[model samples]
Every structure is written in C-alpha cells, then in structure tokens.
Target chain A: MQFPSLEYLIFFPLAVAAWYAAAPRLRWAVLIGAGAAFLALASPTHFAFAFVLSLVNYFAGLALERWAETRKALWVLLATLAFDVGVLGLFKYGNAVLAGFAQLEALFGVAAPPRVLSLVLPLGISYYSFQLIGYLLEVYWGRQPAARHLGHFAATILFFPKLVAGPIERPHHFLAQLAAPKPFDPADVTAGLKLLGWGLFKKCVIADRIAFVIGPIFGHPRDFSGLPLAAAIALYTVQVYCDFSGYTDVALGSARVLGLELAPNFNHPFSARSVTDFWRRWHISLSSWTNDYIYRPLSMVISFHTSWRRVGTVFSILVTFGVLGLWHGATWNFVLFGLLHGAAVSVEALTSRARTRLLGRLPARVADRLNNVVTVVFYSLSCVLFRANSISDALYILGHAFVGIGHAAPIGAKRMFGRQYHILLLGLVFGALVLGRWWTRRRPVAARPTWQRWPVYYAVIAAIVILGLFQVNQFVYVQF
Target chain B: MTPEAILLEVNKVFAEVFGNPSITVGPTTTAKDVPEWDSLNHTALIAAVEKHFQIKFSLREVMRFQNVGDMCALVRAKTGG
Candidate 1:
C-alpha cells in the first residue's frame, strides 16, 4: 500500500501496537507475519515470490557457510548470485528484450513471433533481491556469518518499511538490529512523529504541487520553449529530490518509532561541489554498494594489468556508472543519463590535481560557491535526460531552452498557477526550504528546545493540511 | 621490520600518494581523516603499500582494514616483525 494512503495510516499504527504488545522472544514471528500480511495486501503473487526467494537465499547462505574455503563454496556462491541476477533480469528486462528482438526481425522483413508471456513486475523485487544478493556475497566473502534464524533472515528481507524503496540495508547492519530488542521510548516516538510530519509536508505539499506545473511541460516538451522549459527542468530537480527523499524520510521515521535505525539516503545532494561529491551524497547506499562490489574489483583487476592507473580508473568509473544507469530502465535515455554522469565523474577524477591547484588560487568561499553553482547547473541539465520521455525529446528541449530567455510566456500566469494564491504558496514553500537549510546548517532543529521544536512541528503539519495535494501519488523511486 | 619502521614507510607512501607532503597518519587515522584519501586513491594507496612492504593482501584483507592501525597490524603480521 502507498505510504500516504488512509489504509496504510490505519495499518501501520495497528502493526506497531501489535508488535510492541507481543512477547520479546516472539517479536520476530509477529514481524514476519505482519510483513507477509502487508505484502499480501499489496500483491499476493509478489508475496509468494519473495517468500520463496528468501527461502532459497537462506539455504544458499547456509550451504556457503558450511562449505567455506572449498571449491564447493565457490560454486554455491556463483550459483546463488547467478540465480538472483537471472530472476531480476528476467522480470525487469524480459519484455524489453523480446520487443527488441521482434523489431530486429521486422527490420529484416521477417514476421515476428507472437508474444509469449505477459509478466507483472513483483513489488520490491529489485530491492529485496539486491539485499539478499548482498547478504549472500557477504557470507561468501567471510565478512559476515550466515544468519542462523530463518525468521530473522526473512524479516530483514521483508521489513515492510524499507522493502519498497530501500536504503538497501546490508546484512552486517540490518540483521543485527533485527536480533536486538527494541524497547519503546517517548523521545524516539516524538522524533519519529516530527520526521514523519516533515516528510509528509515535503511530499504532499512541495513535490506534488510542483508536479502540477512540470507534468504538462514534460509530457509535451515540443510545445514549449525558452524560460518556461528551463523552469520546468529546474523544478523537476526539486520535485524528484523532495519526492524520493521524502519517501526515505518517512520510511526512516516509521522505523525509528520502533527504535530501529535505517540508513540515511540523501545528504543535501544539491549542495555538493562536484559530480563526484554528488554521487557520494545522493543515493548513498546504492553508490557504496556498486563501489564495493563492482568498481573496486574492476579497478583492482585493471590496475594489476596496466600501470596507467588513470585509464583504469576512468574506464572502471564509466562502466560502473553505465551499469548504474541501465539499472534504472532499459530505455536509451536512461543509458545516456548514466553515460553522461559517468563521463562527468571521469573528467572530475582526471582533472582533480589541476582543479585543486586552480581553486587554491581563489578564496575558499568563492571557490566553493563557484563549484556549487557549476555542479547544480550540471545536475539540473543532466536531469532533463532522466525526466524526458525519449532522448530526442530531451535534445529538443535542450536546443530550445535558451531560445527566448527574456520573452513573456504565451501561457498567462493565471493558467500556470491557476490562482495567485498558488504563486504565493509556492514562493513561501521555496523560501522555507532555503531558510530551513540555512537554519539547520547553523544548528540542528532537533537540538533546539521543546518549545521551539513544537512550533516547527505544528507548522509542518499545518502546511500539509493546507497546502498538501493529498492525492496520494506513488513515490517516484518505487518504479525502479 | 619494526612497527616503527613500517609506520615510517607508510607515512612516506601516504604523503606521496595523496600529493601532500605534510600528511602524517596515526594509528587511528582513517579514510575520513584525509580529504584526498577517497575510493579512487584508496586502491592506489593499498597497491603502493603492498609494493613497499613486499606483501600481497587478499581482497578480503584489503576490505577489512578500518584504519591506519589495522594496516600496520596486518603489515606486522605479514612481515613477521
């Protein structure tokens, strides 16, 4: 179920209450049962698929642990990884591959075969599969022991809060939390409520409201040009950040109420001074995962073969990011999005020494501001590729973005905002975001006095009630 | 090689690899402690250390080092100092 829906609102509190009321030793059973019920409420078929995969992975971990340091262990590890990746590939890309094959056949003047199967994507399949794969690999690499309790292992994979759009929990961290007992604390509850409110405001008010403007523009970029198109692109950057990060915040807040800590996903990514810094801050869990599993090993092998470390570093970064891009979707736009980021990062790495020297010549504040602006502009432009329906559509918008910079839009302000109040509301929300960032940079909101904190909390709730779209749009990252 | 001697060599390696002659790592110094010691430089740093110490580290071993102290301990164990 969607996080913002009424059903989830009722279901989550009940689940939490039931969980806390259960005996400490029986909590895992309560959690597992709740997780199953949650998944069933969404999709029973997906629930069944996830259950079977969990069983397979659990056994795989056991087998690997038992056969450690032997060739048998190697085979088990390879087999498990292959099976997990194969399942993911089949479900995620099978249709795209088949359609491509049919198109190729048509290009050669041959009749294509009829469609074989209509596959429905299982919810959270991509996320849970990667978590399980990471667990299995950790066991294989001797980094962590195989989980002895099946219920605990299952709970880690099926934890309802992070199961959908994940901070993709690692076994070393998440499993240990599952094993520990979580006693309720008033402080944690208050913090969780505050965080949840903030997330809701960001999603329902900022993101969804902004979507009203950009939705039409992105849907028909060909009809627009100049400043409006640029504004749409820039607003999209804000919308996506608010949407995804809002989801993460809600997930984290929900977990925190139960005294569980989920990893932080975003770290003020827009403020990053470079593309490399942006990756480090944005989607931290996934970036670190790819870095450890894909980039490091590839770099090791390449560095071994050649003394030209720069070439190896550049190549590894490009390939790793290219894979990251493809992970989003099978579309060529996604591929270009990934390649563009990869190229940017590669360039940053190669020119690090020169950039450092050049920046050293300028004042630190000026250098930081310059880099931040450049990074923000670069990311905003790159996001056009991500948001566009096709590569050609993206190019068309980019080509016409500067066509009439100072000209008044053909569409009037009343049409754009629907009312003058919306313009005021949008301005206020945008100002609050900037002010909130500045305020937090000076002193964390949480560290403030309760009298001060309560006003902020109530204000956020007020914003959600007054300004929120309340349409319960699906979180942006759930599609991946 | 003594622990002191290995630390001296490691200091030199860190300084050269990070391009900062003033870098002097202590036992608890980690990747977070050095601005230049990012992932790209990390592999190069490890390779440089392996070459200097004339020892090979398994990938697992390489991944396990949490700080300069851990690296020193591993070097000592491998070199039988």
Candidate 2:
C-alpha cells in the first residue's frame, strides 16, 4: 500500500502501539511480520516469492562470509547475483522481452506468440533486490558482518516502512539498530510524526496538485501545445520530486518512529545549480548507490590502466547510467532518460574544469549564475524523457515546448494561472525549498527542539488539507 | 612504507582535497567523521591518491575499502612496500 493511503494512515498507529508494547527481543519479529502482511495486501502470491528471495540472499550472505577463501567467497557472490538477477529478469523485464520478440516475428511475417503468466510485480522488488545485493557484497568483502540470526537478517531486508519504496538502507547503517535494543524516545516519535506530516504535504498537496496539470498533458501530449506543454513539463518536475520525496519522508519518518533512522533520500533537488548537483540532490540513495557500486568500480578500471583512464571514465558513466535508466523500467524512453542524464553529467564535468579556468578570466559570479541557469534548463529538458511514456512522445514534448518560444501562441495569462494554481505555488514551494534547505543546513535535524519543529509540521498538514489532490496514482518509482 | 607513512600521505590528500588541514587520519575514520568526504569528493580523493603514489587501484580494491587504514593497506599492497 502507498504510504499516503488512508489505510496505511490508520495502520501505522496501530502497529506503533503493538510495536512498543512488545518485548525488546520480539520487536524485530513484530515489525517484520507486520511489514510482510502489509506487503501481502498488494499481491499475496508475490509475497511468498519475496520471502524466498529474502531467505536466499540472507543465507548466501552468511555463507559468503563464512567461507574463508577469497576465491570461494567470490564464487558465492557471483552465483548470488546471477540468481537474484535471473529472478528479477523473469518478473520485471520478461514481458518487455516477449513483446519485443513478437514484433520482431511480425516484421518477418511469422507467427510470434506471447508467453502468459500472472507475473505480478511484488512491491519494492527493485529496492529490496538492490539492498540485498549491497548487503551480500558488503559481507563478502568483509565490510559488514553477516547477521547470525536469520530473523534479524530477514527484518533488515523487509523492514516495513521502507520496504516497498525506500531510501535504500545499507547493511552497516541499519542492521546495528535492529540488533540492539532501542529505548523509547518521545522526541524521536514526535520528530518522526512531523516528518510524516511534511511528507504528506509534499505528496498530497504539492505533488498531487502539480500532477493535475501534468497528468492531462502527459496523458495526451498531442492535444496540448506551446505554453501548456512547457508548463506541464515544469509542473512534472515538482510532481515527481514531491511524490518520491514525500514517500521518502514518510518512510524515513516511520522508521524513525520505530527508533530506526533511515538515511535521508533527497536534499533540495530543485535548487541544484548543475546536473551534477541535481544528481547529488535527487534520489540520493540511488545516486550514491550507483556511484559506489557502478561508477566507482568502473572508474577504478580506468584508474588502474593509465592509458585507458579517460576511456574508462567515459565508458563507466555511459554504462552506469544506462543500467540506472533500465533499472527504472524496461523501456526505450527510460534508456534515453539514462543516456540524457549521462551526457549531461559528462558535459557538466568537462565544463566544470573549463568553468574553473574561465572564472579566473571572467567575472566569477556572472559565470556561476550563467552556469546555474544553463544547468537548470539542461535538467528540465532531460526530464522530458523521464516524464514521457515513449521516446517519440518525449521528442514531441521537447520539440514543441522549445519550438517558436515566445512566438507560437500567447498563453492566456488568466487561464494558465486558473488551471495551474500549483504552477504559481511552484515559485513558493521552490522558494520555501531553498530557504528550508538553507535553514536545515545551518541547523541539523538533530539539533532542533520539539516546539521549534511543530510549526513546520503544522504548515505541511495545512498544505495537505487545503491543497492536496488526494487522488492516489501509483508512485512513479513503484513500477520499477 | 610503514602504516604511519601511508597514513601521512592519505591525510595529506584528505587535507588538500577536503581543505580540512586539521582532519586526523585514523583506522576508524569514515565519511561520517569528515562531512566533506561525499561521493564527488570521494572520486577526487581516489584520483588524488593515484597521482600521489603512482599506484593504480582496481575497482574492487577501491570499493572494498572501509577506512583510512584499509585504504593505506591497499596502497601498500599495490606499491609492494
């Protein structure tokens, strides 16, 4: 169930009650059980598959750690990845492959048949699969110890709040909390609730509201033109950020309520001055994951080979982002989304060096401002690929949005504002996001007192009640 | 190279890239210990290490590193000190 759902709204409190009531030793089991049952609401059959997969990874990690020989551990690690990928491939990408084959057969004028299976995706498979893989790799390499208790290990993989969609908790970061007994902290509970409320405001109010304008245009991009398309793309930027970050807030907050702190998934992404900055801010968990697992590894290949270092960096960026894009879904649009970002990041890296030199030659502030503007525009353009349903549709939106800028049709000022109140609110949200980020940076979340935090909580709730759309669409990232 | 010597160079790189001349190098020191050791800066650190020691690190070696001590050990292994 989506974290913002009314059912989850009620479910969390009751679970919290039972959670704190249980003995410290049994608390992990209670949380895991509640989480597994919660997951069953999406698809009961898939839940079993999830359980089995969790067990496989859990045991594999332990075995990898126990094996004294490096070569033997490497074998176990490779086998585990292959098995996990095989299962993920069958469930997630199997349909796209089948469809691709059918079209190929049609091109050749032959009967191309489709394979049918229930093939329902379990909630958070993409997230948990990645988390599990990270755990295994860490253990195999001796970065983290394998949990002796199977239950604790399972709980780590299936922690309810962040299970389906996640901030992608790491083994070292999260497992220790599960093993230790946590004292009840009223402050943590209050803080977690405030975080939850802020998340709801983001999802229900800002994101959902923006989606109102964005959904229509994206649903049928052809019908709209000029200002509406541009407005829609801009709105989508808010919609996606609020939607995903909103979920992250609730996830992190709920886990906090349980006295388990998850990593922050987003910083102020919209305020980013460059595509590189954007990656730093956006989906921080995933971005950092790719950095560590994919990008760093690839960079090493180049670093070790002096001759291939430059080529390695380029190849790694392309392959890392390509995998990252495809990880979102098995679509050509997603591929382009990955490539576009990759290209932008490469450009940003190259320009940053040039920019440093240019700064010495020109007005630093002006160059910085110009760089920021160019970065925002590049980011918004790349997002067209991220938001569109197909490659052609993305091209259409990009082409028309930029085509004859300020010349095509004068967007009716009144009508535009009337239709997209959130568009106007975008300025406010962006403004608040900037201020809030600055404030948070100045004072860390841990330093804030209970009373000082209440205003932020109340404001978020007020935003939800007054502005939230309340029409739940599947979170964009949930499909992955 | 002794562990101390390797650590001195590691600390020098950390100090230069992160601009925290006071940052101490220890076996347990991690990114959390120094706020500026972020992903982007992480790349800078590895790049700096390669340039400093003239030793290449495989991706596996770089990713598997946990702390300053581990990184020093990896550099030593590669340089055959």
Best by DockQ: 1
Lowest summed lDDT across 10 adjacent residues in model 2 chain A is found at A406-415
Query: A380, model 2: CA deviation in Å?
Result: 1.6
Model 1 clash pairs are none
The sequence of per-residue lDDT tens digits that candidate 2 reaches over residues B1-81 is 888888888899999987679988787898868876755457768888988999777665677778887889888887888
- Candidate 1: residue A462 lDDT (0-100): 85
Candidate 1 docking classification = acceptable
- The global C-alpha lDDT for each of the candidates, from Candidate 1 onward, is 0.85, 0.78
Candidate 2: lDDT of A306?
Answer: 60
lDDT of 2 by residue, A1-480 (tens): 877778797888888888899898888788778877788887776567767888998889888888934788889899999998888888889898888888888899997567665687778888888888878877876667887887777777778888877877785677788778588999889889878888888888778767765665776777666777887777787678888998888888898898888988888776676787788888888888888778876676666666554566667788888888998888898888898888877765546556667676768777667767787777777788888878788888888875554322333342334655566776687788788888899796447997877676676677777767675576777767
What TM-scores do the predictions have?
Answer: 0.94, 0.86
lDDT of 1 by residue, A1-480 (tens): 778878779988987898788877677777777778878998798888888899999999999999988899989989989998888888888888888888888999999675645887788887888888888878887778999999888887888888778888886687788788678788887788777888888899988877876776777777677887888888889989999999898989988887888888999998899999999999888887778777887887777666878889999999889888887877888888888999999999889999999899999999999999999999989999998988889998888887867333455332455544654788888899799889889788888998987787788888888889875468888888
Which residue runs of candidate 2 sit more than 4 Å off their true CA positions? A107-109, A302-306, A362-364, A404-459, B7-60, B76-81
Candidate 1: lDDT over CA atoms? 0.85
lDDT of 2 at A8: 91
